[model samples]
Target: MDKNTIEILFSERKKVGLNLFEIMKEQGYTKISFSNRVKISRPTLNHLFEGEISSITTFEKYLDRIRDVLQVQEQEFLIGRRTAIGELQVAFSCNEPKGYHPGEREKEMFEILEDLINLCDFYY
Candidate 1:
């Protein structure tokens, strides 16, 4: 997930909101019917379509339901940036050059931090 990919995902989500009403019209799905199908309240669906609330969980649930109904593959949802700052902090704290050789706990922490760093690089 580079910056360009993240931007594209955000753009798609915005487009989805705009197109949702059109899709509902094309599918002959009333507001109530779409709400029931997505297991969300009518007001919540309206807010989502209006872009009033940005709830990731709600959006994901709605999208999953819509994907199933439309026979489309589930789209990847982007939540936030991956900085790995916490992992970097932990990794720096794990440095015990004067203390001891790599023990089990140290090794585990190092491995976890390394993986986090790798993922951050891959996704950032």
Candidate 2:
């Protein structure tokens, strides 16, 4: 492939990685849980999502397993429809009511935030 074509291919692969990560989250899968489900190490899952994978075979294995678990069509996964967020830095400051106890929403928020931060760290 020409230089431009190679760049486009890499860009699409990065999109696929991001989309797969989102699909996992939407389906209520954590890195550990999803890695276990896919029979991949947590680090491997992390690399795959970060688009830092070096081996095509390894990438295909993860993609195949994820595609099966997500029940998404191959085309949809490979050519992900969701636009990849270029770069995002989100900050949130919240205080609960004085007498209020945290609930499921708060717990979920914390978990999601942790995951998002971990994901962001991969790009740096």
Candidate 3:
């Protein structure tokens, strides 16, 4: 989309880390443990979370597996829902920007983030 929408999207994407951290704690999983259990290498998981987009193709495989494990469809979890996590009542997922076509790098990263958000919702 336009520059303002892109900026907003990027801003929202960063907040998923807290959601993820909460989810991991709720599920009793460390990064290493989660990676191993999910059959995704630690570095790949790191890359996905850190927005490192060099391995986009490889990321899709891991994303699919993550989605399967989370039992969430790719397009089904981005809506704003109220999920209680301790005292935090954050939106269950980020608001996706409409009519936006992300670049190769961002496309991969967004997909990963979206699936992970869904995974977080599933876990919590």
Best by TM-score: 2
Global Cα RMSD, each model: 15.8, 8.7, 18.7
Lowest summed lDDT over 10 consecutive residues: which window, candidate 1? 73-82
* Alpha-carbon local distance difference test for all models: 0.59, 0.71, 0.54
Name the runs in model 3 displaced over 4 angstroms: 1-26, 76-124
Task: Kindly indicate the candidate among 2 and 3 with the higher TM-score.
Answer: 2
- lDDT score at residue 72, model 3, on the 0-100 scale: 47
Clash pairs (backbone) in predicted model 2: none
> What are the clash counts of all predictions, listed in order?
0, 0, 0
TM-score of each: 0.46, 0.56, 0.41
Cα displacement (angstroms), candidate 3, residue 35, comes to: 0.7
Minimum summed lDDT over a 10-residue window in model 3 is located at: 73-82
Q: How would you encode candidate 3's per-residue C-alpha lDDT over 1-124 as one tens digit per residue?
A: 3455334434543243344433544557777777877797776666555545344345455655665665544333233332554444335444569987667887787788778876765443
> For residues 1-124, could you state the per-residue lDDT of candidate 1 as single tens digits?
2455434534567556545655664567777777787777877777666655576555655766766775543332333223355223333556567867887987998788899886753332
